[model samples]
Structures are given as structure tokens and as C-alpha cells.
Target: MNSIWVITKRELSSFFDSLTAYILLTVFLGLSGFFTWLYGSDIFFIGQATLQPFFSIAMWTLFFFIPALTMRMLAEEKRSGTIELLLTKSVNDWQVILGKFSACLALIAIALLLTLPYYITLSFIGPVDHGAVWTGYFGMLLMSMAYISIGLFASSITNNQIVAFLLALFVSVFFLIIFDVLAGNFTGSMGQFFNFLSISTHYESISRGVIDSKDLIYFLSISFFGLMLAETSLSKRNIVE
Candidate 1:
């Protein structure tokens, strides 16, 4: 537990020291704000007292940004041969993985927190669907967790950050887009299966203020599976060395 917190803080400090955190926060806020207030189907255009536009735009923005954020979590460590040094310490593989995951998730949560002004502004504009807005934020966090784990897994399998970034994006695309498309093209059990595999399905469900157990399970399953894979990969590497 203390080990995990140490790694989390170390990773976070590195993010800030390198200016990655600032850049990510700026870009995320810029893009989300642009589409939510100034671009097509913006709040003014829809005239709705909801942050759906922001949520929708954020879904896509985070989809890309998360890979970039996580690309170096383990890949750079492996590339620089620091992973072995760290693993030789008191912490185990799972602690390291969890710490990196927590750091990335915390950064994302901060990004989302900065957007609270959007919710506050909506409240002033009209009657906002407070329940739906909160749920939407919750859904974003879950979705981010799933992707962060996937990204960490990708980072673990290779020592190249670019390869990790691309791999993570490729795997995430299946859950974010491909499965949704396949679900639309199929029917019966096939469609149902694809729908169940689609992250969008669960995210949309939660964003609509319907927090089903199944939705929670879908995100958790993906996150846990990805983290397990990452831990396994790291363990194998340690054994090889």
C-alpha cells in the first residue's frame, strides 16, 4: 500500500517535472471547451441545459489522449533499463502496475475536475440534469480506467513508447469503435455479444444516468484483465533477466 503510493507520487512528479501534465491538461481542456461551446452541436447550438456535448467530445478526446499519457508508463522504464532497478526494491509487480495506473487515473480525474465549471455554468444557464451530468463524469472515469490499463499493458509488452502508443490505440479502437459497428451490423446473440463487448455501450448507459451492475462489470472486467496482462508481461520480463 505504501509502496503503491510512493510509485504513484513518483510517477505524478515526473509528469509535472516533464511538463507532460500541463500540456495534456491544456490540450484536453482546449479541445473539450472548443467543441462544447464553440463548435458544431455546441451547447448554444443545442440550447439544452446539459453537458452531453462536452461529454461526447471528451469521450473521443480522452480516447486519444490517454494512450499518449500512458505510452511511457512502462515502456520507457524498460527501454532505459530502470524497471529492473525498481523491481529489485521492496515493491512487487502488482504494486508498480497499480501505482502507475493510479497516477494516470488521478491525472485524468484532475482534468475532469477542471471541467466542473462547465456543470456549474450549465446550472446557471438553465435547468440542468444534475444526475445525468454526474453519472456522465463517473462513466468517463471508468472508461479512462479501462483504457489506462490497456495502455499500461501495451507499454509493458515493448520497450518502445511509439509502439506502445500505437498498440494501445489499436486495441482500444476495437472496444471504442469496431465492436459498436459490428454490433450494429449483427443481430440476435451475435449482436448482443458485440454490444456487450463494446465500451461505448456501457459508457453511454452510465452517461444516461442508468448505472447498471452489468455496465460496472464491463469496465471493471476490462480494467482488471488488462492490468493482469501487464503484470504477467512484467513478471515474464523479470524472469528472463
Candidate 2:
């Protein structure tokens, strides 16, 4: 537990020290804010006390942003041979993976929290559906957890940050779009299976204030699977060395 927290703090400090956190926060806030308040299908245009626009834009934004944040988490460590050094310490592969995962999730959570003013402002406009708004935020966090784990897995397999970034994006595309498209093209049990794999399907369900156990299980399963893969990759590399 202490080891995981130590690595988590170390990773978070690196993000801030490198200005990655600042840049990501600025761009995420800027893009989401623009589409939600000033650009197409904005809040004023809808004239409703709802953050659906923000939630909608954030889903796409996070899909791309998370990979960037996680690309260097392990890739750079391996590239610099720092991963071996860290592993020689008291922590094991799972702790290392979980630490980086927690760091990335914490950064994403901070970015989302910064958007709370959108909800606060909406409340002043009219009677806001507080339930839906909070659920949407919850959905975003769940989605981020899934992607961060995927990104970490991608990073773990390579020493190149760009390769990790692209790999993560490629894998995410299946969950984000390809599965959804496949689900549409098929029928019966096959269609149901593809639809069940679609991140959007579950995300939409949760964002609509329908927090089912299945949706919770889906996100948690992805997070666990991806992190396990990352740990496995790290372990194999260690064995090879």
C-alpha cells in the first residue's frame, strides 16, 4: 500500500514537473468549454439546464487525451532503463502498475473536477437534473479508468512513447467505434456480444442516470484486464533481462 502510494506520488510529481499536467488541463478545459458553452450545440443554444453537451464532448476528448497522458508512464521508464531500477526496490509489478494507474486516474479526476463550474452554472440557469449531471461525471471517470489501463498496457510493451500512444489509440478505437459499428452490422447473439463490448453503449447507459451493475462490471473488468496485461508485460521483460 505504501509502495503504491509512493510510486503514485512520484508519477504525479513527474507530470507536474514536466508541465504535462498543466498543458493537459488547459487543453481539456479549453476544448470541452468551447464546445459546451461557445461553439456548436452549446448550452445557450440548447437553453436547458443540462450539461449533456459537455458530457458529449468530454467523452471524445478523454478518448484521445488519456493515451497521451499514459504513453510515457512506462514507455519512457523502459527507454531510460529506470523501470529496472524501480523494480529492484521493495515494490512488485502489480504495485508499480497500480501506482501509475492511480496517478493517471487522479490527473483525469482533477481535470473533470475543474469542469464542475459547468454544473454550478447550469443550476443557476434553471432546474438542473442533478442526478444526470453527476451520473455523467461518474460515467466519464469509469471510461477514463478503462482507457488509462489500456494506455498503460500499451506503454508497458514498448520503449517508444509514440508507439505506445498510437497503440493505445488503436486499441481504444475498437472499443470506442469499431465494436459499436460491428454491433450494428450483426444481429442476434453476435450483435448482443458486440454491443456488450462497446464502450459507448455502457457509457451512454450510465450517463443517462441508469447505473446498472453490468455497466459497473464492464468498466471494472476492462481496467483490471488492462492492468494485468501491463503487469504481465513488465514481468516478462524483467525475466528476459
Candidate 3:
């Protein structure tokens, strides 16, 4: 098999073999649907319907959920002594990383697809901006990539899944609303820095209606930085083992 497909198959199979995929889809769909319909009002304009209710709720939900999905990506491999075995195979560090990342992204994409009913409902109740909704979906995809990368990094740092989960959650959440969360306590440059660091700032800009290039760059950078950190940590592990 080719590199991408090789990782894709492994990750996809892993999700089905365990109950993780089912649990994530159910929880995400149920919660997001509730918030959108109960809170946003189907008939009323919901600021793109995909923004305030769908994308906004997704931000908070992904903060806790993505880590759970990814905490075991590498942590479990190491804890099981499988990391060493896998390393000895033809796959290099990046192949392993890409495979795992691709798998997680596929699962996330599936979860996003399951949320389509919300859009159908919006169409039924009133006219919705198809462009904005599409953009919001793109923003969610970017956020997923960024979160999964960070979660993978956290998992790489240790063999404990719970530790991996919490670490990823904290990092993702901090950046998710870093500025808004810290803004109230400080002012001026400090506040400016916090705002600059917040993931929400970039995500919100994209979710509004347009696919801004700068926002795309920020997500890609964070995702790259995250995966790079994970690869570095694994390299250290290889040397020690």
C-alpha cells in the first residue's frame, strides 16, 4: 500500500475495533444538535447557523473531546511496547506520525459529516448562507487538524493516556480562548499577546463568511509545530530506548 493509504487503513481500523469512534460520534452529534436547535432557534438567524451554535459549540467540545480521541495514539503504543516494534519496521518516524495523524483526521471528518442534519434543518426553517456554512465547515476542519496535532504531541511526551489527554486538553483550550480567558486579568500588550495567541480569534474570522489566508496559515503553522514537537519527542525516545 501507499504511505497515505497505509496509515489511513490502520487508523480507520483502530477506530472501529475499539468503541471510541462510536462514542465520539454519538456525543458530538447529540450535544451539537441540542445546542443548535434548543438554543439557536432553527427559524431565527444563528449568525450563519454554523458559527454561534455549531462551530462555537464545536470549539468547546473539541477542547475536551479531541484529546480523548488522540491521547492513546502514541501513549498506548509505547505503553504496550509496540512503539519499538513499529520503529523496527520499514516505517520511519514520520510515516508513523502521518499514519496516526491521518487516521485521527479521518475520524474527525466522519464526525463532522454526521452533523449534517443541522444544516438540513436550517434550510427548512429559513434561508441560510451556503458560503458562510461552507466556510464554517472549513474552519472546523482546520481546528480539528490543529487539535489533533497538539493531542498527538501530548501523547508522545508520556506513556500515560490520562496525562496525555489532560495535557492536550489544557494546551488546546488555552490557545482556544487564551486571550479572552486571560484578557480580563490584564491590559495593554499583555492582553494583546493573549488575544494573538487565542485560537478562537483565527477560527472566528474564518467562520464568519470568508476563508482568510492568514487564518489558514495560523492553523497550518500550529498543526505543523504540534506535529514537529511530537516527532522531536519520539526521536528522543528512540535514542533512549
Number of backbone collisions per candidate, in order? 0, 0, 0
The order by descending lDDT is 1, 2, 3
lDDT of model number 1: 0.96
What digit string (tens of lDDT, one per residue) describes model 1 on residues 1-241? 9999999999999999998999999999999999999999999999999898998999999999999999999999999999989999999999999999999999999999999999999899999888999999999999999999999999999999999999999999999999999999999999999999999899888998989999999999999999999999999964786
Task: Report the lDDT tens digits of candidate 3 across residue range 115-213.
Answer: 877788777766778888888888999999999999999999999999999999888878876656896577899987777677888888888877888
Ranking by TM-score: 1, 2, 3
lDDT digits (tens) for residues 1-241 of candidate 2: 9999999999999999998999999999999999999999999999888898998899999999999999999999999999889999999999999999999999999999999998888898899988988999999999999999999999999999999999999999999999999999999999999999999999998988889999999999999999999989999974786
Model 3: how far is 236 from its true place, Å?
Answer: 0.7
Off by over 4 Å in 1: 238-241
Worst 10 residues of 2 by lDDT: 232-241
Clashing pairs in 2: none
Q: Please identify model 3 stretches exceeding 4 Å from their true place.
A: 40-51, 184-189
Query: For model 3, what is the error of residue 87's alpha carbon versus the real structure, in angstroms, after optimal superposition?
Result: 1.3
Q: What is the Cα-based lDDT of residue 208 in candidate 3?
A: 83
Global lDDT scores for all candidate models: 0.96, 0.95, 0.84
Question: Candidate 3 lDDT (Cα, whole model)?
Answer: 0.84
